[model samples]
Target: MRMCSADLNLLEKWTWNSRQNATYAGDLTSDGYMSTQQLAQAWKQKFPGLLTDNRHDYLFKFVNDQRSSTTFRAFTEGLFRAQEDTYDIAKETDEKLLRPYKFCSSWVKNVEENNDTLTQLRTFESKQEYKEMITNISLRLGFNYDIQKELVKHMYQMCRYNKAWDVSQISPWCAVFTKEDLKRLEYAEDLETYYKYGYGTPMNQQIGCTGVKDMMDFFKIHVDKDTPQQPRSSVRLATAPALLLALGALGARRDSAPLTADNYHSAVALARRWTSSTIAPFNANLAAVLYKCTPNSNLQINEQYQVLFMENEKPMNLEECRVGLCNYTFVKNRFGLIADNCNLDFCNSATKTTGLIGFTLLFVFITKLL
Candidate 1:
């Protein structure tokens, strides 16, 4: 189990206090009370590698465990000299050191792969350049796990988007994408100026970056038609164990009793829900509502299937309800907020008019009823 930084800081405090105080101060007892000295030494012995390299991270394993408080009774024994002095340590470690360290460590481990894509990517000066290179590479090789590093890089940048998205402060970003990214993007439009950074075709073209659909078209024309071998399995070697663990966590009990067919289906659905990038859990219910609301709706069987898995529906914000792939006609016909045609200008105008009219009609209807 990986340790969190919060737990690590607590362990560090205990270790510091234990070193100052007597090693074996507490009286021995049959109730299994561990002294401060005993606890630190036990942890050191248990995580020999962590103690040598990163002791705080090492101690996090014990502190994070649910049984740690019960098992390591010394932690609860209140042996620390003072709580006030140690407070600053917690605040500084997380923001100043641990987060950056974790980011850099993840980068080094992920980028050192024996591939040319990564090697060439490191030469790029800007994120836009890197993205263009990735788009070009995908055009040639078809999408595969080979582009995982680039995906990670995009994820890192996206995380920082709309905030202090400065990658220059970090070593990995400085080395890979240049060291002058501190100046935040001027606006949302600036951030999404590239078509590659946004979704779908029209926006991708308008934004002047390659869209995923372009990659799909290229793969269809160049790679998929030429491939003679069986379709490469989407499932990777690392997938099964994680899936099993997820299943176990989600309350599958194969050890106690055999899983039913329903149980298997439910588990698979859960996995799909978790893995889906476009279709959110709420979108499933939204689709169901759309299907029920629209009279003789034109939704495909697969589209309907997208919503049927959900048993209950939650309220979604207007933006949240707006999903990709599904046509606007269903929503427009039912709510009259979306335009009949899919043009952005018409859609935007109709959305505002629909909201005003819908609310005003409701007010008038209620007044008349009263």
Candidate 2:
């Protein structure tokens, strides 16, 4: 582990790669983020006038805005637009980096078939359409981040025999991965302390129960047969979504009673409360409370659960689901997941993926630079 940590020190730049979880370990393995900070700091150091937050925001907009550009109208379009089935990132990195990964032919074929599906999602007219898309993905693929979060958190809570078993989607608190530092067997106590203090606020009444290093321990036990049928749903949470899924699974066995319609509503209500009322960010524990209450065999809640999913089988917006008298069943009118669509950030919210990617990429780049 010490040797691997040294190697991460050598690599120079990277970020918490969700696709390659745990491989990076903790404490920002790469310089991607630092590069941005360094650049920001440098700019601040160079010009005091640009230090203001609003100015920085304006500068960010000006860089991307064509109206502020001196170049021709078609020039900027060509910059961001893909050319000849290749993106700018692809072209730039194609020669410099020997691309180690490529989608299999089968994956591409599936993508081709789903082109329209992607188009619908891309051109989704409203929030309702987007939420419907989320549901469709969950229903068909058994991939709802919320349900998956609930289940994984349950797993960890129920089966968390040790600190190694705790972890939910992309744990920032956990150490970055090192081939040598695969397991912190020596400093398990410190790891546990970090978790306890780092994730102080509880989601599913659990704190410091997440870390990337526990991935190995999670696969060894929680993944064995006879486990719940929907582990794959963890992909939706993106980072901690996967960890939370495992945690949800581990946490469930700790449940005092099985989730049912009578108690399930409260679980859902609690989940809503955690999400809305609490100051904490999203986590698997919150997810567990919501789905754990989902009656396992009771068809009433289960059937109603189906409606919770979109036609495509994806998850729905939790905030949109009102606790008082909101329809637990699907209500649609040509507008694609209409009832689930109203008043959502997913639809109108812009900084959905770009901001995250920008910061993460910068973090990785800076790691390399440093």
Candidate 3:
């Protein structure tokens, strides 16, 4: 008892409180340990996030006990160890910075392997083909048809934005794509072919959740690859400006019509030169664009929930799906693209200014700034 720390003191207090002034301390539990209800109530107060008031919550499952002294002792020890281990703020901040990478990597792998929408991307060939695929997948996955085309199309547009192409034999020259595609055509040789066909976006969605620090690291990777041609100053100077300029120079203005074959073909030609090495961050950006084309509809949703469900086995209702739509502002802020007011003006202006300066200083290294 003398060696028992503050946690033990608190545990004793909780035990006594649970007994409600009973004469004997042994009255806390018939088995001489706190009951599940007592442990749950204590955990709810101490670790509210871990244990909701629901009958079968996270902590209850974690401890795996209706009546067990082992779980109680482990829980008590964990809290004490956590408190003792987190003394340095700097260390905690470093861990916080590194945490998202682990989360993003784990999340990306899970979704790529599991999400039916993304998986369906590999087999896509034509609009009709995709519609049929979606119909089948919806039936197989227990998704209702009311949300079928909407969900499938959401993923379809993202695939296009990511530079995936229609590789089906049905229409080899078709510029327009559906949710179905055999392979992404993002790595073409000619500018016309590449712009028309290349999956110019990054290989994965890891970009959607990264920050400025991660962008800097990404630049470092390209710098190491392009050492003789790419100087550190040039890399830093060109990135932001190049993105702004490419976006500004975009020729095709968005329209209200559902994207037609003609519309897609023309848009790709107009923005052919406007390429991205890492298009993952643009997932949210593209979602924002699609939302404008059709606001307040299911088509406007981001892929976060789609990806999240791949890692988590928890079932979600349709209402929950509709309610939990990811906001454009939220996504931008998550990736350090915006500052206050959820406005892109600050970031855009800064990038444009820096891009111009960088362009002047590093003219030779100015190939594909974004």
Among the numbered candidates, top TM-score falls to: 3
Question: Candidate 2 deviates by what RMSD?
Answer: 25.8
Clashing pairs in 3: 124-180, 124-181, 125-180, 125-181, 163-199, 185-198, 186-198, 186-199, 241-355
Q: Top model by lDDT, which number?
A: 3
lDDT tens digits by residue: candidate 1, 1-370 = 2224553343234322232233222222222233332433443343343223221221111222222223333322322322222221111112111112112332223222224323222323245644454454343333543365445455334333312222233322222222222211111111221111122112211111111121122223322344312221100111111222222221211222221212223443233222212221110111111121222245443322111111112222232133322222432332222112212222222212211000000000000000
TM-score of each: 0.16, 0.17, 0.20
Tell me the alpha-carbon RMSD of every candidate: 27.1, 25.8, 26.1
Model 2, span 1-370: residue lDDT tens: 1224443343333242453344333223223222323444443343343232221111110112221121111222232232232222111112101110011222222222335323322232224433443343234323444234234323222222112222332232222222222211112222221122212112211211221112222222222432322221111111222222223322221233322212323554234211211211221111211122244454334322221211011222333332311122322211122212322222223222211000000000111100
Where does model 3 exceed 4 Å of error?
Answer: 1-106, 117-120, 126-184, 187-209, 213-370
Pairs that collide, model 1: 195-209, 196-209
Candidate 2 — which residues are off by over 4 angstroms? Answer: 1-237, 241-370
lDDT of 2 at 102: 16
